[model samples]
Target: MTAASRGILRVVDSDAAEAERNADARSESQSAKDTAQLVELSKSGDREAFDRLVRVTHRDAYALALRLTGNAEDARDVVQDAYLRAYKGIDRFRGDAQFSTWLYRIVANCSNTHLSRRQRQRHDTLSIHTELIDTRPEHDPALQGDRAELRVRLDEAIRKLPERLRSVVVLRDVYDLPHEAIAAELGISVTAAKVRLHRARRRLREQVLPMPGEVPRP
Candidate 1:
């Protein structure tokens, strides 16, 4: 193609991309408005509105639950519990934060509880003294594990984090919530959220890629 034609094509592509972005922004704005209205109606005891709100938000909620719980079964259970609790407490929601934010907090809390209960059950079933499994990869100059294996290791490390640290790290890193928002959701100070995230990341690095003489956690 001639230089002028190529330039024209590039301009067209740029305009199309910009228009797509604007459309996405408008769609997100409309979704937020719709969600707010649904929250108000649900708070007023409208069951159908609450069901509509669930349909709108369930996919994202399940994604968050899966990230937090690290398994599909546990994630589904956490989501169910979270929504039930939210329904029971909707009258107390008070609109202090976005409905999605509030729902995410409930999901996180439910995941923590579910995982804790599962851990206790495992402990009861297993021997009194549990053995830690060290999952160090092959001794390559570069840790040559594939991306999927690395992700599994990371998920395992996140799962082993204490509830407080796990919640903060997942909110900040996985969900990309700001420290301020995380603190608001968790009802903690921003400083506490930052501290927990730093500690969680440090622990994760230790577990996922231990230095010489350091023990990797299970």
Candidate 2:
């Protein structure tokens, strides 16, 4: 082909690829918007709309719970509780944040309850995680055993944290609650929330960061 003709063909190919990407991005954006509308409808007492919302968001909600609780069983429970709480509190959910964010907050609260009770847990957390990893679809089958150990180690690290510090860290960083909100939740000053979060991070960094192997993180 002539040099100019070849160059023109390359530009056209590039433009076509760019347009395709843009179209795909727009499609994703529109899907997200539709989901948001479904959330609103669910809030307004539409049962089918809420069911569609669950179908769209349940996986993500479970992931959020898994990350927060570090045990699949606990994660499942947390996710279920979160959805129930979300449904009951739907009217209280102002339009300030994304519906997913609201769900995350509920999951986080549920996780905190579980995490705190973990101290008194009857069964071994590590063993539960091991069994869970064995069945998890996301992990490589070969690496599941090793990854479960890592997750246990992480749970150990978090468990080592003081309850006050742990609560703040989980709420602020894990669940992405603001300091002010955390303060309100914990009945502390915002300054106290910030201090506890800082303390929690420092301890986790010093303790968990230097661990020899990769730990399955939340």
Candidate achieving the largest lDDT = 1
For model 1, the superposed segments whose C-alpha errors exceed 4 Å read 124-165, 178-193, 202-218
RMSD of each: 4.8, 8.2
lDDT of 1 by residue, 107-187 (tens): 877887887789788643322111353644543312658888888778766766666777888888887777887777667
TM-score of each: 0.72, 0.61
Error of 1 at 217 (Å): 7.7
Error of 2 at 178 (Å): 1.9
Model 2 Cα lDDT, one tens digit per residue, 122-173: 6443433322222233433333346676666556666656666767787777
TM-score of model 1 (CA atoms): 0.72
